[model samples]
Target chain A: MASIDIEAEIRAEPPARAPVQRVTLLAALSWFAAAAILLLWQDLTFQPLVRELALIWGAVGVALVALGLAGSRLGRVGRWTALRAPWLLAIGIGMAVWTVLTAKTGLLPQPFFPTPQALLEVFIYDWPKILHSASFSVWLLAKGFFFGALAGFAIGVGMGWSRAVSYWATPLLRYIGPLPATAWLPLAFFIFPTSGSASVFLIAFSTAFPVAVLTWSGIASVNRDYYEIARTLGASPLFLITRVAIPAALPHVFVGLFMGLSTSFAVLVVAEMLGVEAGLGWYLQWAQGWAAYANMYAALFVMAAMCSGLITLLFRIRDRVLVWQKGVVRW
Target chain B: MVASALKTVPQAAGTEINIQTVSHHFDLEGAPLPVLDDITFDIEPGSFVALLGPSGCGKSTLLRLIAGLDHPAQGQIQVAGEKVADPDPSRILVFQDPTLFPWRNVRANVALGLEAQGTLKSEGHRVDEAIRLVGLTGFDKAYPHQLSGGMAQRVALARALVNRPNVLLLDEPLGKLDSLTRMTMQTELVRLWQQSGLTAVLVTHDVEEALYLAQRVIVFGPRPARIVADLQVDLPYPRHRGDPRLAELRHQALGHLGLDSSW
Candidate 1:
C-alpha cells in the first residue's frame, strides 16, 4: 500500500520545469544522427574508440529523452538541461561534421586534422605517458604559482601602504613587470641549475607581474573613508592593513589571480616546449617531431582541460570568499 | 554563559569636547581653500549639539577634527581635558554614509572596534547587545550590501555604539535616509543618546533636523565657516517635529543661514 501511494504521488506531481522541451528532443536527434553517420557510413576501418564514441552518443541521446520525460524531478538540473539543450545539439552536430570531414573522406586532407578515432587512440595507447607528463607539469605549475602569488601579494600591499616602498618599487615594476616570461627563457635556463628550476622561474615571473600590478591597483583604490572608520575605531596600523585593507581589496586580488593563471599557463607551455625534458608541452613538441599529429592533439586536449579546471577551481574559491559581494560580478 | 568583560573597562560614558578658535585649510591645486575659519565652541558632555550650516561650510570638517581623524591647521581642539591628536576608540565618528565595511556582516562590523582593541574575545556579547540596541537584532549575519540604506546606517550606529565611546561624533549620519526613515531614526537617535549619556555632536544643514535633535544649534556661514549664531533649543526630550518652539528655532537657524523666508 505504501509503495502504491509513493508511485501515485510521483505521478501526480505537475511539471514545474518545461514540459519535455522540444529542444531536448532536437539535441537527442542530432546526437543520434552523429552516431548513425559514424556507424552506417565510413570511408576507413573505424578504431575501437570510434565505435565506442558512437555508442556513447547514442546512450547520451537516450538519456536525454528519459530526462525530459521525467519532468521536474531534478528541479534545477532539469531547468539547466532545458537551457543547455542548444549547446548539446550544437556539440552533436559539430561531432558529426568532424567525423564526415576527417576519417570519412579526404575532403579536409590528413595528419593536420587527425581523425576523431585517431585522437582517441592516442588517449588509449599512450595513457601512461600522457598522465606522467601532465602530473609533472601540474606539480611544477603549483610550486611556481603558489610562491609567485604570495610574493605578488606582499609586494602589492607594501607598495600600496608606504610611500617609500611605492616610490622605490614603482620604477622597478615598470622596468621588469611587462617583459614576456618567454623572453627570459634562454637566460633563465642558463642561470638556473636545472631545467625544472628554469621553467618554474619562467612561470613564476609570468604569474607575478599581472598579480602584482592588479593587487597594487586594488589596494591603492580602496575607499579613504574605510581608513577613517577603522582609525576612529581604535585600529592600529597592522589592523588597518590586515583587517581593513586586505579584505576590501580581495575582489581585485582575485581578478589579478585570474589574469596571472592564464599568463602562467602560456609561459608554462613555452618553457616546457623550449627547456624542460618532460611535460604536456614537451610531449606536444615530441609528437610533432615524429609526425604523430594524433598524439599532439591528445596532449593539447589534456592541456586545455587542465587549464580550464584550474580556472574553475579559482572561481569556486572566489565565490566562497566573496559571498558578501552577491550580484557584484561573476566570471 | 560568558560574563560581560566589557564592564571591566573604566572609561566614562560621556566626556566634554572643546574646540578653540580652530582654523583649517585644504590645498586645491596649490591654492589655499579655507574650510574652517577660526571656529570656536565647546560641547557640553552628555548632550546632543548640532552644528548647523550651509553646504560646503566645513561643519563636517569640524566634526572630523573633533573625532581626531584630522588636525586643525592653526588652533587646538581638546576632549575631556586632553588634546585630541589621533583617532581613539573613546570618540567614534559616524560618517554621512554608513561607511560599513562591505566585507563584514553586521555582527563582525559592529565588533570591529572591540576586535581592533584586542577585547573581542572577552567582550563579544557587547557586539550582539549593540546590534540589538539599534533595533537590528536579527540582521547580525547580513552583509552591508544585503541591508537597505536606513538599516545600513543603523549598523553604522551599532558599530560606533559597540565601542562604548564617550563622545559620538555624527557627521550628518541621517542625511542620506528617506524622509520617513529619517523621522523614525531621529526618534531612535534621541532615545539612543538619552539612554547612553554620550556626548553627541552632529553636523547637518537641515535647519529643522538640527532644531529638532540638538539641545543647542550652532549655525555657521558659507565657506571658511564662521559661527553666525548659536541658538539654544530649550525644548524637552522626545520633542515633537510639529512643535511651535521647533518652528521658531527653525526660523532663527534659517535666518542665520541667510535662507530666512520673507513670507
Candidate 2:
C-alpha cells in the first residue's frame, strides 16, 4: 500500500519544463508587417531604390526565420533567442516604420534624414574607400592604446607602490589629467614630424591619464591583508607586486582600460579632423565639406558600429580573464 | 585518525621561541596607543601553548610580532636562536580570517609559500600532500569563495603546513566556525600538531578550546596586555568536552579573565 502511494505521489508531481520549440508568433507577425510596409508603399519614384529596399527586408525576414529554426535545434541558441527575440522584433519593426516615414511618405525631411536604401547605396558604392580609412583609423588606435596603456600601467604601479613616486607624480597628474586632449594639439603638432604621429600622440595622451589615475587607485585600494599573507609566505618585493598586488588590482585596471578606449575614440576623431587625410574622421569632414549628408551619416553609422564592437570584444576578454569574479561582480 | 594525513611529510624538529621584554605600540593619528607591555615568555620546542585573553588585549599583536610581521618597540623575539627581523615561511601565522587569495585556487594557495621561495618546481608535490592533509584533496581546484568557513580555514591550515613551518602561530584560526565545526577542528588541530611535531601558539578567548587542545595556557589581562596566569594541563589526547578536568580548567581560565564562573 505504501509503495502504491509513493508511486502515485511521484506521478502527480509536475514534469520538468521543456524549452520552447515552436516559432514565436509575434516575431512572424512583425516580419509580415515589415514586408507589407515595404511592398505597399508606392511613394518612391526610383524603381531600383524600391526593389533594393524590398530585397533587404525579404532577406532579413528569411534570415530571422532560419535562425529561429536553428535555435530550436540548439539549446544555447534557443535560450539566446528566448531572451532576445522580442527586443529584436521591436527594433526591426521600429526601423521599418522609420524608413517608410522618412523615405516613402516624406513625413520627415529629406537629405538630413537620408533613406535607409540611400545609406545602403552609399555603403555599397564607397566600400573600398571606407574600408581603407577604417583600417588606418584602427591602426592608429591600436598603436596609441598599446603605448598609452603600457606607460600608464607602469607609472601607476610605481605611484601606488612607492611614496616618493606618488609624491612626484600625483602633482603632475593633477595638473595634466583634466585638460582636454585637443589642448595639446598645438604642442603635439610642433613635437611630431608627421600629422599621423601628432594624432597618435593626442590619442595616447588622453588615454594615458585616466589609465594611470585608475591604476594608481586600484593598487592603493588592494586589501592590506593580502600583502600580509604574502609577506609571511617569504614573498619578495617583486612577488608581492606582481602576484599579490597586480591581480588584486586587475578589476580596477579593466575599468581604466574601458575609460581609455572611449577617450581614445573621441581624441582619434578630433585629431583626424585636424589635418589627417585617411581615416573615418577625415571621411566625415570631407563629406561635410561637399555637403554630402548621406555619406556623412554613413561614416557616422560605421564609426558607431566599430566603437561598440570593440567595446564588446573588450568585455568578452574581461569575462574570460576574471571568471572567478562571476557571481560577485555583475558587469 | 587525522594524524595519518600528517605522516605523508616527514616532521622536522620544532623551533623554540623566546620573547623578552616585548612591548609594542601603534601610532594613532600621531598619538601612541600601547598594545603589549613588557610581555615576556618562552615557548619550548614542540610544545602546544594557547594564549587565552579578553578581546582587544593585544593577543593578535603578540602573534604578529612572533611571526616577524612586525617588531616590538622595546624588546626582541628570537626564533630558534635567530633574532626576528622580517617575515619567514618557517614561522607561519594563520589568521582568524583564512585570508586565502581569492584569485587563487586551493592548490595555488598552498603553493604560495613554495612559489615565493622559488622552490615550487621541486616542492610542488607538497601542495598536493598538504591538500590531502587538510582532507581537501577533491577541492584543490576550488576557489576560496566556494568553500564554507570551516573548509576555508582548513585550506589556510594547509597553506601554512605546506611551508613545513617549525612554529605555527594561530590567531584564533577557528574562532569564526560554528560550535560543532570548532570542536571538530580543535581535535584535528591537536592531531596535526602531534603528528607534525611543530610548536604552536594559539590566541583564542574560548576557555574550553584552550583547555582541550593546549598543554599550557597563558592568560592575559585587559588592554596593554600582560601575562596574568599560566596554567598547565596534563590531559590525555582526544579529550572529551564533558570531562570534569577540562571543565575545571575552563573555570580557572574564565576566573583569570575576571569573569564569574558560576555557570
TM-score of chain A of each: 0.90, 0.87
Task: Enumerate the candidates' DockQ scores in order.
Answer: 0.76, 0.75
Provide TM-scores for the models.
Answer: 0.92, 0.93
Per-residue lDDT of candidate 1, residues B82-185 (tens digit): 99999999999998899899888999999999999999999998988898889999988988888999999999999999888899998999999999999999
Least well predicted 10-residue stretch by lDDT in candidate 2 chain B? B1-10
After aligning candidate 1 to the native by TM-score, how far in Å is the CA of B116 from where it should be?
0.8
- TM-score for candidate 2 (chain B): 0.95
CAPRI category for model 2: medium
What TM value does chain B of candidate 1 have?
A: 0.94
TM-score, candidate 1, is 0.92
**Highest TM-score scorer:** 2
The lDDT for every candidate, in the order shown, is 0.86, 0.85
Alpha carbon deviation, residue A76, candidate 1 (Å)? 5.1
